[model samples]
Target chain A: MRIPVGTAVAAGSIVALAIVPPITEALREPFYLGLCLRLMILAIAAISLNLILGFGNMVSFGHAAYMGIGAYVVGIGAFHAVEDGIDWLANGFLHVPLAIAASSLAALVIGAISIRTRGVYFIMITLAFGQMLYFVGVGLEVYGADDGLSLYMRSDFGDVLDINDNTRFYYLVLALLLATLYGTKRLVASRFGLVIRGARSNERRLAAIGIPVYRYKLVAFTVAGAICGVAGVLLANRTDFVSPDMMHWTRSGDLIIMVVLGGMGTLFGPLYGAAVLVLVEEFLSGVTEHWQIVFGPLLVLVAVYARGGIAGALRALERRRG
Target chain B: MGEPILRLRGLTKRFGGLTATDSVTLDVVEGEVHAVIGPNGAGKTTLVGQISGEIRPDRGRILFAGQSITRGPVHARALLGIARSFQITSVFLDFTVAANVALAVQAHAGHSFRFWRDAASDDALIEPAAEYLGLVGLSDRTDDVAATLSHGERRQLEIAMALATAPRLLLLDEPTAGMGGDESARMIDLLRSFKGRFTILLVEHDMDAVFALADRITVLDSGRILVSGPPDDIRADPAVRQAYLGDGDT
Candidate 1:
């Protein structure tokens, strides 16, 4: 029996990511490890966004707000730990839960209002909420505000793990990414996932069939926000920095680009998108300063010609070969 | 006849200056095939919309099983055993026919927050979904995407979905709307087979279907009931013929 193209792609990527640490050490190039870590973290964010965007048909434009909220939780926790002598606040246990809860709360409020709207209206409402959070981050003078803040140190997990060791941190991030991918795969196939997909397909019919679509959508939005917050927490730890810019609208656009470029509805599409987009940006920037001039047209061409993005193109090729 | 399962009292809906449904009151008896027939723009769809909770009546009460559901949202009414099919054939076109019916069954099974087990493979949902599809004679087409089915098959799928809800009142909006002669006969036979097992409120422009299936017929003209009675009485009534049936176009 032959493996599906998607499975092969996912497996190949996972193996590549798993060996990156050793490969970097062998080649004496640590920069690629850092880049891969960042890619995986953003892939987590994209996956979270896809849960609502691709599955639930909610095109949220403010998803980065949750990531920013997660980053700030860590940044603020570390700030208090150093300046106010509140050391427990710096614990990873506190940081992760706090980030999840804070982002979930924000999502609940935002989703409560925004989920009622559809089409471009929903998009605008989410964008507005995101902008509001961005400005609030800018006004947070106690933290670094516009300039941003540096973490006092990596989150403390006691003797269980040391995130200061880049390899250990890389593995931890990879584990989270793998968990997210697996969890999302299960989620989309589960009853709740079917409800979300049903809503995406025909919300009226779902409601007519006795599914309270608004409640499900709100739950999905909150779940997505919470997961994205975790991604933000990992991002802050990886970079040792947190700022309003992390949750800026453009960052949210970048996440959408990743989802669209990979495959909107497929399980591993966002991972492919995140990897390809980052690599393309890195390679293009090296070639010229005006990289967006080349990138803009390329994105448009994908949008116009390849409606399913990279995953779709790969599936088409597989079908042809078969 | 059994006591009224659904009562619409003074139902009124206006779009801007146009009164779509005006102070219309009607009762749908339990286990009866109640047909609401009218000319174009005569408010049959609007009246159905009010009962199904898609449209809020400007002034009226919708009583289902002796409980007021005028202000209840669409899904709440659905849970209370009301299901409706659209005239334009609205369904989850991307999903399999079985999956579409399964989703309807899953809606009533419990809260769909089970986020682990694969829904596609669940025997609990798929079994009942297959039963409903078989009832509608769509057993063979269960695995096909809904969009791949013919128009009549989609209508059958729609009925299957509505039936899977185990609804107390099935609201069918022009189930034979665009059907050819053979397909329409099959739809009629399907509805004929469901005559007593399901309480249906049918909105139709097809005179033959209305006459053949309706135990009671309510004729609407200019957003108000022209008359309502047994099929023979509706057939004999001159006012209904002049207002709707005599148009010759139908």
Candidate 2:
């Protein structure tokens, strides 16, 4: 099947990104490619969160725990697998899959408890749970005790998929990110997606029409968490290390900022948001150290003036042009 | 043709110092209009809430379609064929009028998990939604955003959505709460046309509409039923006349 129109544009952008080796020798560095990979991972994570907060109307503030748990799955798996001298499964492919599953299961338990309440209470409970996980993660002296753990070798998915090769891993991130955007678009427009949109619009009305809203929301949250687990596994691979800092509250804020900056409730918002956020952190900081002082209020102004965020602004421009 | 579609036995609710609904016992027979009327703050809305499974009672049982549904959640109560419209208009304002009704129909037509198909373009959802909109006289405004519709029109759309679910019992709170005189008259005509087709529990402030359409009347005041009877009897009863008509206001 064909990819969507917006995704076709993104596909072209990736082709341009692939040709960076000719333009600047510095652009071809593994360091720069690694940075782009990091952005893609965060975008994947933010898009997952959007399904719950934007469409489901369930604002979960503590989504970083899935990332942390996903990170630790690799850390702990590699530690035990290496110590036992079992070279068969402790590698990247086996470890990352285990990490994804662990993250999703943890999300299920966390979502079940958090979905009972709504509004601000839901946000707080989820944040509390994420913080609790972060504390536990930090307490793990077994995985270097707050200092973090380094991977001795990147997980190898046998012969075809070598994460250590920057080009191969970059392509991998690009494919997954594009696929996530496609999957999310299909979901929001689908029948289940309509239920999600309805719940966000007026949950009571949805219930009065005989649709089980709570279960639907829980399922959305779990699915969002499962998708986020993929981002976490990739983040661990990109870093070649795992840390409790991945679950920190500020990191969660960064994720929210991406979703908000891109736009909430609109498709392709996360892509624009992720690209803007990562580019700002990389480029703006180069000009001055106090870049956030400028960036902070700008973001605030964007939120205050552009309630629909950048997408709304662009749409406004399009309307003016036409 | 069948058992009472909805039954309430001593449904009671208290709001701390205030009791909203006290010992409300109601039965809505299949295929009839059962209207609840009273002055402002008379607990009519609370009774509707209790019956529709939004608010649980302190003590009592609610039966729907001849089965105990007291323990069921709101959607469960709805799936058993009871639907409700709000006092304030509650459509998704940003969506088109057709989309709002289609969402209700979508909830009933099939599982909403079909991700690839455009929900709006699906004829299965659109055709029935258009029919309901036409039934409510909103077909011309089908593509219009709900927020742009006139107030009375939104109220009509509210009813249109409630009906889209194909409910056996419809609980309507202030169905014409903000409508003009003409809108109120039109709503009564709509109710009259809908009578005996499906059961309805209407809570309205309009005395004339109530008297015009109620097959049976239940008068509530201070969370207690002042009286319950035929419209003619309730109209003449001194207690209801004094409590609702404000001694001489009617």
Candidate 3:
């Protein structure tokens, strides 16, 4: 049997990402490693958003809030670790779990209210909640407020893993990205995922068939938030900085664009989306400072011409080849 | 012939000054097809909405299987063996026809929180789904996407989905609404095949299908039941004729 184009591309990209650190080291350019790391981290966030936006048909505009929450959890924990002499708070084990728990809690509360509305109202309510989190970040006076906080050190994973090393951290992020992709694949194909997809397609029909669509959607929303929180943790470690800007509504917009650009419901779409967007932005900004002017029309053309984004275009090509 | 499977007592509903259903009281007997017939704006859809738990009555109580379920949510009512098809075709258009029915089967199977196993390959869902599709004469289209199906085929798929729920009472709103003559005849035959095997509360505009398939008919005018009886009695009733059947305006 012929391998699907999407699967081939996804597998090829994974192999390529696995060797990025070695190639960058040989070239003596660590910046490329950092860029790839950033790409993978954002890809994780985009994948989480796809759970709701692409599969569940929830257009959440405030997803960046969870990433903000995750980063802040680490930042605050490190702050307490250094200032208050609470060293255990610096543990990666503690910070990662706490971030997941906190972000899921926030998602639960936001999803409960937002899932009641649909279409533009859902978008606005999610945006409102996201902005609420952004301002809360700004109001945090002890945690460096709007200026942001710097981590004295990366998350302490003990001897089990060394996230402080650039090469080691890249692998860690890569592993997590693969796990998210695998877990999501299992999730969307599972009974619970079918409920989510079915609800997206026709909520009323699901209700009439005895499925409580609201509860299922809220769970999917929370799951997506928790996964995004993990991405946030990695992001904080990668940059050694945490700020309210992490969860700004514009950042959330960036995540949405990544999902749309990759392919909304496709498994490997977000990764491709993140790569293209980060690489294109990097390339365009290098050519001209006003890169957004060029980028804006480029995205519109993709949206109008390619209905399903990059992954969709690939599938179309494969179909034509057959 | 059997005790009431569904009872609506003093089912009143209003939208501002317009009373959509004015104290509409009705009973659906077990193992019978009871069709609700009315002219435009006579509140047929609203009545179905209240029975299926989509719309809350301003003042009323709905009982199912001799239990009070007046304020229960839609899914709750569905779990209690109530299922409905919409006036407009409603299905998971992106899913395969089998998958659409599989979702209905999955609903009645158990809690859907199992997030590890692949649902599409589960024979437990797919088998029952296929059986129901066959029952609706849609077995051939089981793997086809629901969106690709024609209008009448979607109506059949809707019935298959409702049947998969193993519901005790089926609420069918306009099942033959947009069908051609041959399609309507086929639908009537399908409903006729299900006459005694299931209890159906049908809201429809096709008088011929209603007359042909209804074991009992309730005629509504101005949100109130003008007359109700077997087909012969409904045909003979002058008020129903003047208000609905015989009226040239209909």
- All models, DockQ values? 0.94, 0.73, 0.92
Relative to the true structure, candidate 3 reaches a TM of 0.98
Please state the error at residue A311 of candidate 1 in Å. 1.3
Q: Which candidate number would show the highest TM-score if scored against the true structure?
A: 1
lDDT by residue for model 3 over B42-65, one digit each (tens)? Answer: 999999998888998999889999
**Predictions in order: lDDT:** 0.94, 0.82, 0.94
Q: Evaluate residue B26 in candidate 3 and report its C-alpha lDDT on the 0 to 100 scale.
A: 89
Query: How high is each candidate's TM-score?
Result: 0.99, 0.94, 0.98
lDDT digits (tens) for residues A1-322 of candidate 2? 7454444545665675565434434655666766677888888899998888877877778887888887777767667767776676556667667776787788888888899898889989999988998899899998987888887656667787887876788778888987898899889887788888888888888888878887788888888888887888788888989999999887887888888898887676766787788889888899998889878998999888998877667666656655
Q: Compute the DockQ of candidate 2.
A: 0.73
Q: Give candidates' CA RMSD values in order.
A: 1.0, 2.8, 1.3
The sequence of per-residue lDDT tens digits that candidate 3 reaches over residues A167-283 is 999999999999999999999999999999998898988999999999999999999999999899999999999999999999999999999999999888889999998999999
Q: What lDDT, from 0 to 1, does candidate 3 have? A: 0.94
Instruction: List, residue by residue over A1-322, the lDDT tens digit for candidate 1.
Output: 9987767877999999999999999999999999999999999999999999988899999999999999999999988899999899889998999999999999999999999999999999999999999999999999988999999787888899899999999999999999999999999999999999999999999999999999999999999999999999999999999999998999999999999989898888899999988988999999998998998898899899998888888898789878
DockQ ranking, high to low: 1, 3, 2
Pairs of residues at least 3 apart in sequence or in different chains that clash in candidate 1: none
The candidate that wins on DockQ is 1
